[model samples]
Target chain A: MPNQDEIFTWVHTAVEAGANVAFALSGLLAGIRKQLDVVGICVVMGLAAFGGGTLRDVLLDRRPFFWVDHPGWLWVLIGTAVAAIYLLRTTHYEFTERAIQWPDALGLGLFTASGTQLALAAGTPALPAVLMGVISATFGGILRDVVCNEIPTALRDRRPYAVCAFVGGWVYVFAVRFEVPPATGFLLAAGSATGLRAAAL
Target chain B: MPNQDEIFTWVHTAVEAGANVAFALSGLLAGIRKQLDVVGICVVMGLAAFGGGTLRDVLLDRRPFFWVDHPGWLWVLIGTAVAAIYLLRTTHYEFTERAIQWPDALGLGLFTASGTQLALAAGTPALPAVLMGVISATFGGILRDVVCNEIPTALRDRRPYAVCAFVGGWVYVFAVRFEVPPATGFLLAAGSATGLRAAAL
Candidate 1:
């Protein structure tokens, strides 16, 4: 159970790793659905990967957003999407599904925690922070669905996706307020989110 | 030149009509691309139509956003997209393009004016208001581009799109500051935008 600074650093590292994996898998899914080309794959992956954080920063009026600060962030998605698309062409759907779930779950958890933290830092109240957390966790997928011309899976389906984010976010908030060690709280929230999602599946 | 109130009325009318057309077009494009079912078409259309305004409101932190206040706005896009998609398979692209461009131009002009006006209302400085106007005019297309996995057309090729918006926005700002009638300023701004886009093409 590390303190706040260490927990924040850990969260950042996890999110970056998770984002790359999510970007790759999302591209593979888009290609499998035949709604994307090589260029489209990379584009969707990048957009889906970065859209949430960009929205968070814009709303907070934080200049030089994550993708802007780290130019490599954008390219990571580009490279991952390209590679994923190529590999997906010959891979089995079952294997792809099996491989993608964990990273996606990681991204969902890390984003939920980080988004809540951002909102709190920006002086948003608890309810709004929770909403922002869910938005940060799920907005990328919604954007992807809209662009792909599908009903957003989050809105249409009764999945545990956003619900897990909401619960995890509240857990993080309560833990922080109680002065619990941040790392322990973050891990607990993420672990619970992953468990819920896996159970839902 | 029309009075301020009259100009505002016209601009509002144009937005209403253009919103319908934009929504319709999103469905038509999605259908042509064969990426969606009818429900998906409706979702895409609604998002395309309201997406810009929603983004603007979120960035501006204006509570009870336009769409939230008027749920009818959502229905309007839904109906329009449905009708357009149903009629689209039998239509010719060239003819459709010609008819749609007029409303789109009107929408662009009005959106630019409204965006500038809103920014000014929010007490943003003149230059920022002008920039906001341009963003309002072009953001829908950017949203469309992102969803379709293309570089934002505005940022891609130099098309005089944002330039037209900036000039028109300044026209509105100057008129308002000179105590010219609001409607007169609006028409001048909208007309300037419409003509510039036409001429550019």
Candidate 2:
């Protein structure tokens, strides 16, 4: 079996890449809805993609932030943002308010699982680990809404956003405790979160 | 002379205590103006008091956030917030829009100098350290404004808010480089930033 360090590296890289794309799309749609300028769009996109993980790293005392270490991910985020803007501008497919929920839910589920696992790896207890998952999943949207000058939908909307993440994170922790394969545990967590969020919609 | 660790501890504790009180006051006044509920008031006060420092620690990979290490500061922040709310409600002293500027500027100046110094201690180069200072000083207010669903005053107010903090940080850095006492350097930096912001107002 690979060492703990290898496992951490694998988990961090995979989740970060997936969540970055998902959150970037959400941010791009939100920015377009707000009619922000190009620079503003990029700023919001970057924040949405990176803000949650950045907060997690900070709280965990992890250094040399993920984006800073892999500058290529930033390029990927920018490329996705630019392409999204082009598609929206050229096509008749308008980004309806409801369309953002899909990407947001995807990013939320992915980040929730990843953050919970990371906290567990860092030796945090179970409950705080779950809380970490919620923060990682929800904070990016909160920041995005705040930047857009709106009350964070997470706080204002009575929906089950953070609740889905919290339940999914607990599922992962229990699965891991029961000797579930690490990859399978991740899938279970993400799938549960995404399924619940989609159902809520 | 004290060792580097000793110096860091002294600076971190002193600046943290002072900035906490100042920013807590600013946040309390802001919450009262906005008419947030008690829980909302506490959250804003905590964020204003700790947001910038938390950001800096995350960037620098510092562990066990200052407030986490010394929970006493949380009490201080809470006490200040509660008192401010009580005073605003009981006294005829209306919290005019202008009252916020004083505590905000004071917190900005103190946090700017302390953040710059901490970054230097973390071995960050001069320019990035200056930027960190500006971030530490201004981000709390930005977060507060954003949470309140207003455009950040630092971004909106054509006034030289961040600029003042930047200049003050540089002054502190240069003073330390020229063999000034650490305390004196801090004073110089805080005074310069507060004076500049007050003058701009």
Candidate 3:
């Protein structure tokens, strides 16, 4: 197994890069579906990309927040929102509810893994660490839905959204305890969550 | 004037005790109006009481969150929710939307002053400190409204909700700068916000 520090750094960077884009796309789609203005779309997209991490950081007492330090993520969110808007305007493909699920699931898995890892690194207990992971995965979508004046899907959807993240968080925690390689464990955990969400849809 | 240290301590305690009760009552009324289940009422009340402070503490990287230290707040929230429910059942008084505005405004002002003070104590710059004050005042209501599946009144209400908090926050900040007595400053700031909101209503 690689050094834990290295694993932590890698997981953080990977989640930041991959999950931001996935969640941003998900938010953009939701915004478009809600028929929000461009500014509203950007706001929702930013919330989806950064909301969970911001919540996690606040709970864990991490300073400056993830997006505050990484202004690049904001740029990425804005760019994606703009591109999505342009594509919808110019293209024949209709952005459907199903399209949102794919990116949302992917982002959920990635964020759950990363949040769990960070909490554990900060010496949080196993249960709260797992809860943090779930929060990181689901809170963004909750904020987006709330801002759009809809009941958050995480709270009301019959489909297993938060449940998928919770289970996947436990999977990642167990993988680390068993000394599975970091990259491999990340994939297993994230894949489990993404696959479950996709199947549910 | 009392020492700034004493003033800070007094403001923190005052806001904690008063705002928790006020906001909890507001949440209970909203929950009752929405016809939420008991658990939903508790959850909404807890969010209204702790949401803004949690946001503030998280942003400031304050550890062992306020409620974590004062579990008493949870009991107070539960007690208030239960009492409010009992009162509604036993009394002829109907819970009206207007009934909520009074407590909400009081909590808003107190929270704004305390939040700004804490941020400044932590050495944050002026504008961000003021912004933190506004956040501490308004975010709880935003969370409450969102959970109830309504657009946050702070965001959409034509009446001066957040604006009152913003103005009153600056009032508290300048009061301190001008060496006003702590108790007087507190009352002035809180009253300004509450009065403005009441007038708007």
Candidate 4:
């Protein structure tokens, strides 16, 4: 079995990557529903994929945005969006709309955990760190919705969306405050947040 | 008479303060229309007042957000919101709706010039600086509308809004390129942008 440090690194990388994909997928579906052209579609997809993380990085004063550091994700997102457009052409609107919730929930969980973790690592105090997580988990979808000319469903829906992220952030914070292993905290936080959002959906 | 440098400083301060007040008032009006409570009113107002500038600062990795440095603005904003609530309660919706445009336009002009100038000072390339100006001038209202569960008037209105900012940003860039006085650049850029938006209204 791998050491705790390797496990923590692996979990960290996975959560970030998973959140990026989930957010991008959600954004792409939203853009498609809006009947945006390819360029517009790509822009929204990229925003959903990178917006929250970039905001987190900006607030934390981290340099070289993840997308900048890894241009490969852009190509992959575009390719996926194009392929999905054709694949989902016959897919029902109701189906696509329903499909969005899954990725959105997953992204919320993953981003909340990762954003909070990163802030804690940067020495931010607990409450502000939790807020950073909520912002990271929620703002991308908000930006996408705003650009698409809709009230962000995150705010509009009666569902507990940002609340889940907030609670999940505190979960991670407390886990760290105690002596829980970092990887375990991440798993528990992400799981609970995603589960809460999924239940709301 | 004050020298050119003194005039530049005065103009800079005036434009930034003007933009902040305009944005804040616009947000306050929006919140009142939405019938949000006072706390909601204040949150939305602050977002419109500071969202764009905060976004610019984050993107540029600037430390000490404008609000953090000037807590006095918070008190002023809250006090103004309270005053406006009572003062404008008897005002007609049509009149208030029309009123929002003026301050919003003024904010657009001032923020566009200031954002672009700050980016230029930070050594961002001309095109990126212009883009930054647009973001700074526009995102605050977008944020306000998003929270208010309405389509952002910036995107919905048929008037060429963001385009005006773009053109004005270029005007500033060109003025600087030609070595016009900095104050003159600000005045010309702000005037043209505000004029263009006012014409649109």
Best by lDDT: 4
Report how closely model 4 matches the true complex, as a DockQ value.
0.16
Candidate 4 lDDT tens digits, B77-189: 87888887777777644446576678678888888898899899999999999988998899888888878878788898887999899988999999999999888898889
Candidate 2 local lDDT, B1-201, one digit each (tens) = 899768867865665566577777677767776776554566577677777787777777776666656666666775676777678678887665476667677777888898898899999999899888888888877787778787777898898999999999999889889999887788899889989999999
What is the DockQ of the complex in model 1? 0.07
**Of 2 and 4, which scores higher on lDDT?**
4
Worst 10 residues of 3 chain B by lDDT: B35-44
Chain A TM-score by candidate, in order: 0.85, 0.84, 0.84, 0.88
**Model 3 lDDT at residue A163:** 74
List of clashing residue pairs for candidate 1: B2-B184, B3-B183, B4-B182, B4-B183
lDDT of 1 by residue, A82-150 (tens): 666666667753445566777888788888878887777777666557656777777777766666776
Which regions of candidate 1 are displaced past 4 Å? Answer: A1-12, A88-95, B1-54, B57-117, B121-201
Model 3 scores a TM of: 0.59
Between candidates 1 and 3, name the one with more favorable DockQ: 3
Residue clash pairs of candidate 2:
none
Those runs of model 4 whose alpha carbons end farther than 4 Å from true positions after fitting are A90-94, A178-180, B1-46, B59-61, B66-201
Q: Candidate 1 local accuracy as lDDT?
A: 0.69
Assign candidate 1 its CAPRI class. Answer: incorrect
Which candidate number maximizes TM-score? 4
Off by over 4 Å in 2: A1-51, A54-110, A123-131, A143-151, A158-201, B1-15, B21-47, B57-105, B123-128, B146-151, B155-164, B191-201
Tell me the tens digit of each residue's lDDT in model 2 across A1-201.
999768867875676576677777777877888999877888888878888888787797667887899999888877877887788779887766576567677777888898899888987767667667877887777788788877666654656888789889998899889999888898899889989999999
- Candidate 3 overall lDDT versus native: 0.79
N/CA/C clash count, model 2: 0
